[model samples]
Target: MSLPDLPTGWQVWNEEPDGRVILTFRPDVFTEDEYPAECLPTIYVTNGSRKRRPGAGQYQTEEWHVELFLEPEIEVLTETFDTRDAALEGAVDVAGRFADGDVDPRAHYQIPREDYFAALDRLTGDE
Candidate 1:
């Protein structure tokens, strides 16, 4: 299957044989010196099962979801889609939103971490 087009500043970080893809943004700037690998902005499109909460369930089910991550945190996520194409489209849209600075980590976190905000400042050049 063909993969969706990535945003201007993003690139394919990984592509598994099973069709899962990890896309990273501005790798040229967001290096280890500027940002930690785990905290780098990313979009993950996968058909993997939702990670179960601790002691929350027994049976595991698979679903297609587009996850928008700002470094070590999930800033946004979409409801599960039945098709990979739909998930990919959702992921692409989220990635675009991220590129345009449309996402706010604070909106998701009650109290955003200092380190995370600092990292976000560096990533987006926002003072």
Candidate 2:
């Protein structure tokens, strides 16, 4: 299936032949000098298992998953789907919600970065 149109500040970072897709948000602004690069928001669409085991998700599974991550270790949301297309659609929806300021990334952070959060609010029109 073709990739869907992404919301402002979001882009298709990568797509695998096996249907695993990675979408990134505002890579340009998430620099070391501005917002920490590690905090960049991302959406992963995959058909692999959600198990934490290292190789558990190496093989594709029956269910598709769309996961939103505020950081490498912080997951904001997860949605399951019956098909890859559905998962991609779900990812787009999640991206839209984030771009519209509907998803608050600040809540997931252990140490709040007030300056960064304020900048994000302006970027997402949440201010």
Candidate 3:
């Protein structure tokens, strides 16, 4: 499937043949020097279940899911769709909301990274 136009700072990080898409925000700024590499924001579009159980999504399901994450383990939002097209649309919407600074990533962090938060605010125009 073709990817729709993404908002600024967002890019298609990877696309698998199995129809999974990974979108990342501002990779250039998420370097170890500027920002924590592990804290990079990302969106995942997949046909897997949203269940947390191990191996639950090992097999593809009929439903598609769009998951937004501030970090690898920090899921910010999740939306389910009946089709890949709908899931892609949902992912785009989530990316737009995040790029526009509507979604707060700082709240997900346990240890405050004040500098990183400030930089993120500036990048997302939340400053």
> Compared with the true structure, what per-residue lDDT tens digits does model 3 show for residues 32-102?
98888988999999998667899987778999999998778889898999999888989999999999999
Best-to-worst TM-score order: 2, 3, 1
Candidate 1 lDDT over residue span 31-70, tens digit each: 6786566667777777766656664323334667677776
CA deviation > 4 Å runs, candidate 1: 53-62, 73-75, 110-127
Where does candidate 1 clash, by residue pair? 39-71
lDDT agreement of model 1 with the native: 0.69
TM-score of decoy 3: 0.91
lDDT of each: 0.69, 0.91, 0.89
List the RMSD of every prediction in angstroms.
3.7, 1.3, 1.5
Question: Which pairs, if any, clash in model 2?
Answer: none
Residue 66 of model 2, lDDT score:
94
- Residue 121, candidate 2: Cα error in Å is 1.1
Model number with the top TM-score: 2
Models ranked on lDDT: 2, 3, 1
lDDT of 1 at 82: 73
TM-scores of all candidate predictions against the true structure: 0.72, 0.92, 0.91
